[model samples]
Target: MLWKVFMHHSSMIFLGLCSGSGVFYSLACLKTGSCYFIEWELISINSCCVSMTLILDWMSLMFLGFVSFISSMVLYYSGEYMSGDENMNRFMYLVLGFVMSMWFLIISPNLISILLGWDGLGLVSYALVIYYQNEKSSAAGMLTALSNRIGDVAILIGISMMFIYGGWNFLFYVGDMKDSINKEILTGLVVLAAMTKSAQIPFSAWLPAAMAAPTPVSALVHSSTLVTAGVYLLIRFSPALESTISQSILLLLSGLTMFMAGLGANFEYDLKKIIALSTLSQLGVMVSILALGFSDLAFFHLLSHALFKALLFMCAGTIIHSVKEFQDIRAMGSLIYQMPLVGIFMNLANLALCGAPFLAGFYSKDMILEVAFMSSINFISFMLYFLATGLTVCYTLRLIYYSLSGDFNLGSLFNVGGEAKIMVNPMFGLGLGAIFGGAFLSWIIFPQPYMICMSMGFKTLALSVSILGGLTGYLLNMGSVNYSLNSLYFHKMTVFSGSMWFMPFLSTFGVSKLFLQSGMKYQGIGDMGWSEYYGGQGIYYMISSWSSKLQILQDSSLKVYMLSFLLWLMVLFFLVL
Candidate 1:
């Protein structure tokens, strides 16, 4: 009966679950006294605890507060966002599942629990991605699942290594096992996993592919759930990452990813894909900052990015809905007049994303650059930093320009107006947060001394450089002559080369085709080949082949089945031993 009711009214059930669970979480946080003992639970001989260190600490509190607040707002927004859609209930269930999984992830005390929540979130996200049940959505879902599976395998291997070399008890605190684990090997594995999860370099393709998901899913994933998981892992295990070569690799990969994604966003014509790429770039920046061992700064940036990115994605959804499901920015012109509320919120969010002073992104992003400068005096780091900053400016400006800046071109279009109250309400809430949340949280998160360390003159210089880059991009869009050729080439070259079209033919075609052919060749060598050879022709051939195989198998089944089961058990026992 419960299952039937839930299936029938999944949306209401999910919303109720979210609200109830959130209340429980808040109560647990408030009642729990210490970082390690909060929400203590015992399962058989194993004990588990929720880490409240971040919750009690100022920095973690700010992020937690923002996560909770934004989650609530998005839920409210979803009430209307998916209104009247056939799968609204299913979408709500997935959203609730994602939020709960993220909550668990943030408070996870041990690596095991973290992995649980991590994979749980991935599972929910896969469902959300394919919610529309279209060919594109299905493909995107498969890509996301495959990419996350690769990352999961790496994480599992790393965990196994840690348990083997380090003590089992050390799983609760990665910092404790840092000295025991082989730094080089463990770091390499962890970095591989993190890079895959964060969509760095080659793994970055999955993020853009995920744009086929609903707008709300995109907003949630980009803002605070999926992409942020990698950074969250790094921040949680900062002590271990900092001591290993992983930190340096993270810096290199993140810097490259930021620059590449930023460039890609600049050239992207799809509105959602642009935001998706922008999320990748922004996540890269966060990862880079965390790689520098500035946990507070990274968390700060995470908070800010979540607010503005969510607002931006929601606004994009609103615009698409307003124009009757059109997402091509090239097709969209000045929508500001049609959807004034969306335009205002989107513009504010864009300003914050561009790192305008006093906004959320500005303070956090500036702090990241400051930490990078302080940590590295190398010319390469400086060059990478400069390139990433410039790309950030160009892409952000491009997003603003192509969508909101042009003349009102209703190009063969019809009705346009403000979004549903559900969508606009969330946008309004996120815009307010983007505008002032960073400033409010800065004091608590940064404190006095840390703020002083981050407020150095060189940090100011970096901010100026980033701002100048943004201004230059903005001016050039407006047909200014003062743009530097060096900057132009840097922006264009990076953007052009980062595209899927620029992928090596060997990578896209030769290797993929080779793999497919190898699989077919292997099937031909096996008894499975008989079915493949006959199945495509007609039902008669398929039935004949199947009947022959069934008869042959049945003739030997008893002995074969017994032997196979014994062999499998022996192998399993051997492995356990």
Candidate 2:
């Protein structure tokens, strides 16, 4: 126990220090306008010069700094959040292993090395997701793992394809393969891999299901480590993905994903799942922007969103912890009265999510929208973008209303105020980031401002949708105990929207339903019916009856044995006659 506590504190402090150093070095790299590419030549095969390569650029360094910082805070938060678990040591090690994988992923420009990190992430995430050892967690872990495996397979295929180019260092060849047919195929594979990892479109069901993991794990995975890996990879590979066909496809899928997630969040009641949906929504925003040919903007939002989203998850964790581990928003209300500090931070994070000016989300999210609006995107893409933005605010306000303002719902006996100092302290660090991390990153990432040439109407469109969405969301959710259930009234639509367009069913139950049914059928007829009747039970019954007759004959008296012999002789005489 003491060692577990030490692991948490020691890792937190060490990561915190590393975060600072990474940021300092990143700034130095930016100032010098230079990057360090460290290459260690491994064994040469056919003079191709296979080497372990690291890209120590400002971009990689800065991202490392942010990831390390969020990870440090998450570790400190977990020290309190996971303190009661018997296997806290395993939890600590798993989280650290996750961080290490992200590190390998960030620095490696070689596809071969990237696979090491990529597979590590998928495996460790499965471990973390199933940490509770419950049926739900196991199912969720399976979904998460299998979904990410698609990306892993895509990466493996890409590696195999890259071998034709003499090496797996895709960074060296992405630019040169622009017009090559193989390059297009490789880019498609990379996009597919990114889509699966980032949980876009048809592959999105796992993101929300993954909420079954512990809250701290949710914070780390959703914010910095797992989901963002895909976006980060795209940012690194942006130069190669500039084809119009790829961009258009990415835009469409990501837009739909953004809209779907935001719509789903409004209907969701589980606090953690709602946050998970929000993460999905934001991931959509990142990928959509990346598809629009602004990888830097995508990268910018990635960092800024990480800050507040991590904070958001932490706040949600504190609430879940306090409410006797019940995650339903319907079970929690007027928490502001009991846990004022948490309420403040939670509301702060929510508002940031709404892109209420100047917060971390605002700086990145608002800009992304403006840039999208300004771009030459099709009508469908444009409408999806704005609709999704509106839905984001809709859910955010709805969450605040249900969880913060309404009546106090906890029982009178429950004492659900005053969070642990450890939990609250980590929130403070993230809270500061949620407030100003955007502006800070904006200045650092973009030395020059993005020039906007839009009219006044276009400028206010984002704010307009946000306000409209919030009002609509709040009013729709406002009701007394006698309020009619919207879900019951509009069952079909509710089920469709609330279930992410039946994606979970399709991804999990739908995909496996046939096989599961077959197994049940086989169990009933093959194993329990025919196989048992004829194979095991039939033979047993036959043997048992025969042995009983044999025992009876063996135990028979002399008269009975003599009568049986006479009866057999009489039958033989009759047959002879």
Candidate 3:
């Protein structure tokens, strides 16, 4: 009956095929270097032509391997997680479609081909976000799609401009174009596109809102495919942005995003949202580094962040599933005692996120902070970087203290226990990657020598942000005086931070509320009153009046016509006399 209801074998087989292709292609890239080919010719009217292309290089190859591997693990994990769902087949198919789109995105270098993947991500992710078919899911999905549509439009504009270069293959021109007005335009468009996809600053409301989807989708979308697409595009196109105004804007926006996400995560209580905020923060780090002319480092951090963030999401899914409907930290406490394995994995991920010692996050995050410091940036960027680092540790420690070790406030009736093999197995695979992914990728990805020279001030601050934020987070949460409410006494600040500085408001109702009210006012004055009365009612009344007058004239047509003619003749004779 289960087999009839859900097609597991086919899904598993697809996953295996992807995973095998990824591993094989990654190895092949190491030996053969970058490869590109036109998959098919779509259109060739006159001199313009569009073709599907697959580009394989060390960069695409390795990222594809990682994405495919994670998707496989996630698919495996979902088998047990979604076993009870009524539409398991639908969910699986959506995920498969999502993965296929991601694959097309990974291998493409042309602007037109990339659109196929980029738009697919936005559309498929919307479907996945609304998979639950609830009000919350529907709202989140719309926000996700609309926000992404901004990037989609940006790419479309960029594609139109590509006619200047006589090719739609952006990968060729992005790195090779010399300084010119047209090149700068291309660079600006690329940056705009990247910012939206990566959820940077103004476009950030969608990432956290997207937590409405199932956890596995979050793990995949947030960690590897959707969000990282922007970062990868930037990394590939970093050369176009070098020494341009676009790069400076990127630095500023990324720094702000880092600060906002870090602050929001510290204030957030929802389990999934906190992790989602962390992903946003890490994306900022990636973008910031890329803006500073460290594409390799950015790519490195991207990989490391993906490994641990995925694991972290999976662990969060485990917690949510075990506890049923409760996701608030206040409702969850002393979870380590009931489910030690999941707890261990969760803490491990949190530690890695905070860049503890040698975990996957540490390798890339440490290098990123160091490189950021060495660069001569404005004071604002400087503060945002270090403060964001501190804020990250602050919230992660808060997470552990509140959820892992605090009092068990979730009522006694709910039974919390270990997860089944189907759930736990995928976690272990990713956990192994989380633990060693950073160290391994650091060596593998950066074969060439990467160096940074920083003064003592930068180094000291870099080290201190983590230590101080960690200690303060732990003590603040642990102290008996610091209970949930009325403890901090800074109500305004808490409200600001907790409400994501009203970003969700600013992104959603904040922007629309004023316009919507203005629309209503215009409707009342223009459409309902003047336009309706004048255009519709007034026109009708004029037509009716004319019709009545004409009818009267028609009824007395013979008499009226003779009287009018006689009156006109008399007037003419008087004028002549």
Candidate 4:
């Protein structure tokens, strides 16, 4: 047990050191505008080079820093959160493996090489999701794995298509091949893969479902390692997508994703799932901006969001851990009075999520929205952007009301207090990041501030919607014990909106219902009915009956032998005469 604790602490320290080194290197690279590529040639054929390449640039290094830092905190927190489990060592190893997979992904610019990390993420996440070994966790793991498998398939096809270009290193030739049919197909595949990874639109269900994982895993997965991978990949491929049809499609889907996630989050009651949905919404924000030709902005938001979201999950973990694993918000209230530290940090993360003032989310999210407003986008994209932003605030405040402000609903006998030092320490580390990580990232990523020239209404639009959303969220939830249910009046519309526009149904049961039904039919008719009658069982029964009759005849031979011989001799004599 002591060694296990030591293991987590040691891993945390190591990752923290690596995080510092990566951040420093990233800043140096940014300052000097320098990038290093280390490549080892595997083979060359017809002027196409195949090799393992590592890209050391500001973007990759910065991401590495954020991922490592968050991972370190998560590991430290896990030491206490999962300390009682028998497989603590295995859990620690799995988390390390997950981080290593992200590391491979961050450094590699080669399309072929990137799959090592891409597929690694899917496999390792599946392992982590099912770590609890419950039926729910198993189902969630399958859904997560299968959903990501679509992206894996897309990446594989993309690699095959890139083969035609005589090299798998897309960085070397993507710009040169711009607007060509092959380039479009390759970029389209890449976009499709990113959409699935980032949980955009059609692929959004898995993100919430993946909350069956341990909270520390949730912190890492939702914040950095898994969900952001798609966004990161697109950032790398942004050059190919600029002004193309792929960009337009990605913009539409990512916008819808942002709106859908925010809307769903407002109705969701699960603590971790709400955070997971928020992660999905933020992913939408990042990708939508990427679709708008601001890869740097997307990357910047990705890093900043990672910091606060990790902190948010850790705080949620502390709360859930304190309250004996009750995830339902209806079962929780007035936690702020009991768990003051957790409530403070959780609300801090939530406010940052809402883009309040100068917090981490304010710098990137506010900039992304402002840039979206200034961009030459269609009216639909424009409304989706602002509406989604409003919904973000709506859900965040609703969360605070239910989990932090109301009367404690769990009765007086429950054990709920934030006394875990291991957990609190990580939240503090991330709290600092949540407060200033955005400004720090913005300064490093964009040395020149963006110039905004908009009308008064457009300028105040973000704040206006945010205030309205917060009011709606808070006032709407304020009700007596027997308050009338408004959602029942508009049941169908409420259900549609709350259920992510039936995407979970479409992605899960809608897609699998036919095949599942077919399998059931096959099992009934072939295995239980016709096949049993005519196949192996039927033949066995027939053979057994024949053998039984033959045995009986052999056993009765002594009595009948004399009579049979007499009859045979008479027949032979008659024939001779």
Runs in model 2 with CA error above 4 Å?
Answer: 480-482, 513-577
lDDT for residue 78 in candidate 4, whole number 0-100: 95
Over 4 Å off, model 4 = 45-47, 480-482, 516-577
Please give, for residues 329-444, the per-residue lDDT of candidate 1 as tens digits: 76777777778888888888887887888898888887677667777536876777777777777767766766677645556747888467757766777788898878865764
Q: Once superposed on the true structure, which residue ranges of model 3 sit more than 4 Å away at CA?
A: 4-6, 454-461, 480-488, 519-577
Cα lDDT of all candidates, in order? 0.71, 0.90, 0.86, 0.90
In model 2, pairs of residues that clash are: none
In candidate 1, list every pair of residues with a backbone clash: none
- Give candidate 4's TM-score: 0.89
Question: For residues 333-370, what per-residue lDDT tens digits would candidate 3 score against the true structure?
Answer: 88999889989999889989999989998889998898
lDDT of 2 by residue, 16-119 (tens): 99899889999999999999888888878876767788888898899999999999999999999998988888898899999999998999999888887899
Give, for candidate 2, the lowest lDDT window spanning 10 residues. Answer: 478-487
User: For each candidate, what TM-score against the reference?
Assistant: 0.79, 0.89, 0.90, 0.89
